[model samples]
Target: MKKIKTVDAIGHILCHDITKIIPGEFKGVAFKKGHIVKKEDIEVLLSLGKDHLYVWEKNEDMVHENDGAIFLKDLTAGENLDFSDIKEGKIDFISNKYGLLKIDVDTLLELNMIDDIMLSTLHNNFIVNKGTKVAGTRVIPLLIDKNKLTEAKNIVGNKKIVNVVEFKPKKVGIVTTGNEVFYKRIVDKFGPVIKEKVEKFGCEVIGQAICKDDTIMIKNAIEDFINQGAELICCTGGMSVDPDDVTPTAIKESGASIITYGSPILPGAMFLLAYKGDIPIMGIPGCAMYNKTTVFDVILPRVLVDEKLTKKDIAMYGHGGLCMNCDICTYPACNFAKV
Candidate 1:
């Protein structure tokens, strides 16, 4: 249904058989409107399966089918309200499965409801840093009441909203460091293997090099990648403590700062993270060549989005290992590897 008039009211519904239901047990409530309809209270209603609830102003369009409800006061049929009048509030678009949150302040400010501009920027999804203009009570939508919008803007006080930093993808350089593969003792499988994995992200391997276990050669290869505009670099093989193992030492000698030597994760505990300035230089273990997933799998997403990684960020992988490759894997639609 088309929206008609501006309004501000809580809309909700019973997910259960509310036709003959108790008040507290079956109903859900929410005050925020015009954005995503997801809320914890709605999940409880949907669990009942048989019951479906919706809330909307008597004069406005119905709440979204995906949403739970919209509460409205006494009004006659055929009357509607414009959504522009309703002040915008916290919008949570992150899916429950990912535990992630996406905040769009541009959409919030367009509605003329941001009261405390500074504090609202702190909310999850608000995510803007200092010097970023989040909202302005002074600016009002055309043809709308500036005074009313001003009143709604004042409601937002200095409540701090959490800022979530997002990662953006950077170009990567892959240096496959192994003699057996480089000298044709075995097929050049590592190159194609890593290429496929990196393709799943926004990163591109602009340069590739093959080097033996000589630290000097490896370090030179890394510098070559930096010269080629590679912000991220990966050295495959030679990660263990074998006498010929030199990938870890090579990364250290390249004048790049090491972020962490290893991670506490399965199938990828030997992973290494180092950086030259903000550019990350990683050492991928041999296991990544054969395994369906590994530490590179975890870091790829962060690298794609240019997000900073912390030890705690790496720790989140333990809960993520529950993934079992499905018969029909829906890559983007599923939470299998959006890490």
Candidate 2:
């Protein structure tokens, strides 16, 4: 049996001799045996009433002439199959003789990490019953084994997945630093701005305090939140390089360890990350309040899932442009944040 190269590939049945098949004027051309089907040629074949081909079903014997291998059913036919029913590990057919196949949901979702050359390396797709090959795997399409991909899928299932831009329950603490804001010489508008964004994440502001540029005061307020069981902490103002822009220093002055001080993202570039044991402390810049591109948006999702962020992770946001405050913020739907 030869290795099959593609995931989700389908084949069709050849009804006649290859040489005898006539190519219509509308049809691009006729194909011969052993001719690999491709993207461009698929439509031409479809127009010639060729629907099924010898699809790679893992078992060489199962790949009858003209069987489509990738497409399982006609989506336009209003017929849909639930992948959940297909089980989490192995690609199996309950009552059919289709040899066992491996479908990895994680890699498939993660930008088709497998390539054609690797996909061509696997041979079996249907051979086991549901749950029989719980860790069902393959190797024909590429170097990645089905077992590893299956494991990855299981990992995804076990972890708490968080989708950004969607309102989810969160516990937040706002630490407002700077003498001016702390002394109330100017109304604390920063607090309200942080509050609005926090509410969007379904966050409840459990701990809040006004601290002068003094590091000890800011550190104490952060500690209070940790003692009170705050999952996330936001420190607004005092983020610049000036003598008074001391939020970064304050977060470090607290017991929390800083993970990153800068990010590639606009509006939130001056953000800072610090962790104490497990609690996260964030230093949000003044830009966060006015530009809507503050550190809060970039790291909030990672905080929800407890992911550790590095400088490199923060650098990935540069591809997307600054938020234009468009009428509709179709994030997650549009990946506007581009994190």
Candidate 3:
């Protein structure tokens, strides 16, 4: 840093914040740190009795914070993501569509490890809305070493540190299975519950069927839904190992490859996932009808984006998978799972 005459400081970066105070009216930052001295700023500085200003010295190895922030923004931004203008050497990434937010945790960690550089983002693999701020990046100092920025770029490489996977509009099918519901012995609540959840992702239920605890009946319903252009099918209830529970077997018999039959989560441990050809299918547990949030909520957003889930991916939910069942639930924002 160096001190220069206010008149000559134009186009230089300010090294520290300049305050303006009015005894009765207001007192706030007149010029913030990392602000570039504009032509019009000279008069304001002169009127404030600032003849000399401390500014960042031009150096070959150093980069102004504004430039550093842009570098970080370019490295982190991905499809369906936009960035805000730099403010106080910080830039925020915003989503351009309602979808799932994905972060490259390994690459982000490497970028943050560089000295004087910082990047933070929302948790990976969660739902986000259009215009939502998902991440922020900045430099720790008013001036940072140019080499640090280069190292960050190298760490990022071709990988996007932050991105949003847009949700695809899908025709969904719901298969409400169980003799109680098919026999009308009890009201069928699972269909409505599953429909509400599907609609939240902007998907529509184009076909639905109420089936008894017979594998063949459920298999036929699955085939009928596929014929009706259903891209995703949700089979509710009949997931347990009981003799009456045959949804999982029905899904397999329907030519669908089961991804997982159960998860390491409470209230959703009996959940099942499968795919027939290109269409995804799920066997939702009974708990989903009563619980406000479950593994279904965690995985629905990902499925809407057409993400293929593997058994390993489902197994990872073992960490932070149990729901606290807070009286006042705040899902998608709470630590129900780390997916």
Candidate 4:
């Protein structure tokens, strides 16, 4: 950078900030560093009593901060994601629809490791709504090596790193299994909980079945819902190992393929996930009816987005599967936070 007369500084990059002071009104930088001097800025600089200004010397091998920020935006943005307008070498990722937010964690780490390059994002596997800020990127210095950006681009290849899978509202069926509930000895409390949970994800509860512990009855109830065009089926209760707990068996008998019947998460260890054709069938444990957050809470959003789960996928959830059940319930805000 070198000093140049303010009048000649037009079309030159600013090497330092231009500070402006107003009595009792404002006192801050009027033009930030790295701002390219425009023909109009000459009058403002002269009025601020600036005779000379420091400006960057152009280099072909290096890119300006704002230009580098735009590169970062292209490398990071994917479908259902938008980027903020560049500001002082910084840009942020915004969601364009409500759905699950996913990131390539390994690639993100590798990009941040590059000198003068930075990218940050919310943790992977999160439910984000439209207009939510999910990630941000910024160049660390006013100028950056162009080759470093090429390395980032090479890492990105054809696929952008961050994205959101928009939720698909499904026609749902609820199967409440328990002799007490089926016989009306105890009021049907589980159905309301499951309905509210599914409805929150925009699923329509077409119908419900109150079934006894008998396997045939439960299996028939599930098939009945499938015959009625239920896109997703949720069976509540009788998920434990007790002799009377037969929901898992009934689900198998109904010809659905079980993905993972048990999870490594507390308050949801007995949770089951299966599918018949394209429809998802879940066996929710009793704890989900009482616990503010559980494995069901973690997995349901992915299901709504049509993420086909395997045993390996369910096993990967163990790392952050323990729900803290915080009193305030700032869920989707933290790894272990849930309502």
Candidate 5:
């Protein structure tokens, strides 16, 4: 690119977009790249405080920002994602479906390490709605060394840096295990709570059972739900170490493979996760009934996506597992755990 006086720039093509800001009214590109500069444009440019203009000058080793942004977009965009039209040397990657946003953080970091190349994204494993801006890519300058973008592509090779995993609808079963609720001494609040949480993810509660804290009864309830074709079973209450709290023992006795019995997160440390064949069963503590967000919220989305959780996955929650319990709960948006 070559810089010239605005008056001398007439008839030369602009190498970069010129932004125009009209205080509160507008702020966007007024003159796009490749637009031939005209005599009448000088007065308009001067009003925008432009004394100089950059004219297009091709170089084999350098790439124009618009093309560079497209290259970056092609390298990073993955499944269920769409790219916005390039504007001002940048393009936004939007979600094409409502699902979990997965970011290849290692590769993303490597791509951003390349100078003059940028790829910014939302937190990995975040639940995003369709049309949500998942990521954005751009070149730092109007013209950048082609080698820089090439290096970024090489770093992000083969694997997608950003993608969305759509949630699969499942038949959920609720097992409210506590003597008080089972005998109608107290109303069954856990079932309604679990129902609301699962329904938001597009799942249906196919069956529910109110069982006393008897291990055998709890086991039978879980088996009954499975026989009824429940893909996911939630056992609420009776998760603590108290002798009467046999929900965890019941989950094991039901022949489910236990993944993790305790989480590092507060208000949900007693949580238990297991799977019976392809079915996932969770033993939820009392905190889930009171806390708007807990370990249950931390792991529910992942489960819905059929992402198996390892002990290490649960252990990592220690970093951001404590809930702030703000006056207005903004969960999922807040860092309750590392997604």
Candidate 6:
């Protein structure tokens, strides 16, 4: 591209957009790139404070911002992802299905480390509905060196940086324990809460079995669900260390490997996660019965996708794990479980 005085730029093609800003009323591109400058337009150009302008120089070694954004999009997009048309040198990634949005943070950081290149995305592991905007990519300048783009592609190297994993509606089983509920001394509120939470993630509650804090009965209920082809099992109540709490013990005796029994998250410190072969069984804490969100909400998406949670994964939640419990709750959009 070449620069010229605005007064002498008649007949020359613009190399970038000319923006017009009204204090509060409007802000938009007044003149688009590639538009041929006319003799009569000089006054308007000068009024927008254009003392000088860049004109297309048709350099084969340089790539325009629009084309650069498209190149970057191709390297970052993966399954269940779509992209918007390039505008003002920017392209947005969109989710084509309701699923979990995940980003290769390591790759994203490396890409942003490059000069004149940027890729911004949502927090990793966010649940997104169809048509959600997940990320955006663009170049910092009107044009970029082709060599720089080559370096970006080499860094990406057949790996997709952004993706959405489709959620499978798994059959779920619920085991509610506590003498207060099992003996009908109090209304059983835990079963309904757990059922509602899982169903929203496309999981079906096959059945709910209430147990009287008895390890044997809880274990039997868990095995029964496994025999019934329950892909996921949730055991609510009796998770604390109280002598009467036996949900954790029952989960351990149910032939499942315990991943972690506690989380760093506040309201869900007593949470437990285990796997019986490939089926996931969780000892849901009391927090889940009342709190709007918990560690269970953080781990639920991964479990729904059949991805087993690791001890390290649960440990990472120590940072930004405390929920403010605001009067107007905005989760998944807030910092909770953002690790």
Q: TM-score for all predictions?
A: 0.53, 0.55, 0.95, 0.95, 0.86, 0.87
* Candidate 5 lDDT over residue span 1-339, tens digit each: 798899888867697789999999999998988666788999999888989988976578977777888988888889999888887679999999989988998888888888897999998878899999999998888778988977886788888999999999899989988889888999988888899999999999998899998999999999998999899999999999998998988999999999999999987999999999889899888898888888888788889899888889889889888888888987668777765
On residues 103-172, what C-alpha lDDT tens digit does candidate 4 reach at each position?
8888887888889989988888789999999999999999999999999898877777789989999999
**181: Cα error in model 4, Å:** 1.6
Which portions of model 1 show Cα errors greater than 4 Å? 1-167, 319-339
TM-score between model 4 and native: 0.95
Residue 173 shift from truth in candidate 1, angstroms: 1.2
**Candidate 2 local lDDT, 288-329, one digit each (tens):** 766644457656755654566666766766776355565665
| Candidate 1 per-residue C-alpha lDDT over 1-339 given as tens digits, one digit per residue, 9 for 90 to 100 | 222212211243222223324567854333222333345444543454423334333432323322211111011001111111223322221211211223344443543343222212223222222234332122221112334334433442332122234435467788988888778687766778788777644457797898877899999999999998988888888988788998888888988887777776566778888778888888988778777766677676555556667667666656654445666644334454323
Could you tell me which 10 consecutive residues in candidate 6 have the lowest summed lDDT?
Answer: 57-66
Candidate scoring better on TM-score of 1 and 4: 4
Give a tens-digit lDDT track for model 6, residues 1-339: 799999989877697899999899999999998666899889999999999999987677888787888999988889998888888689999999999988999988888889998999998999999999999999887778998899999899999999999998889999999999988999988888888888898789999999999999999999999899899999999999999999989999998999999999977999999999999999999899789988888888988877888999899989988888988778988987786
Per candidate, the number of residue pairs that clash is 28, 46, 0, 0, 0, 0
Worst 10 residues of 3 by lDDT: 330-339
Query: Which regions of candidate 4 fall more than 4 Å away from where they truly are?
Result: 21-27, 337-339
Q: RMSD per prediction, one decimal?
A: 14.3, 12.8, 1.6, 2.0, 4.3, 4.7
The parts of candidate 6 lying over 4 Å away from their true place are: 1-13, 16-30, 34-54
- Pairs of residues clashing in candidate 6: none
Ranking by TM-score: 3, 4, 6, 5, 2, 1
Question: What digit string (tens of lDDT, one per residue) describes model 3 on residues 30-134?
Answer: 998888999999999898889999988888898888789998898788999888988877999999998989999888888888989899999998788999999
Cα-based lDDT for every prediction: 0.53, 0.54, 0.89, 0.89, 0.88, 0.90
Candidate 4, residue 339: the lDDT equals 18
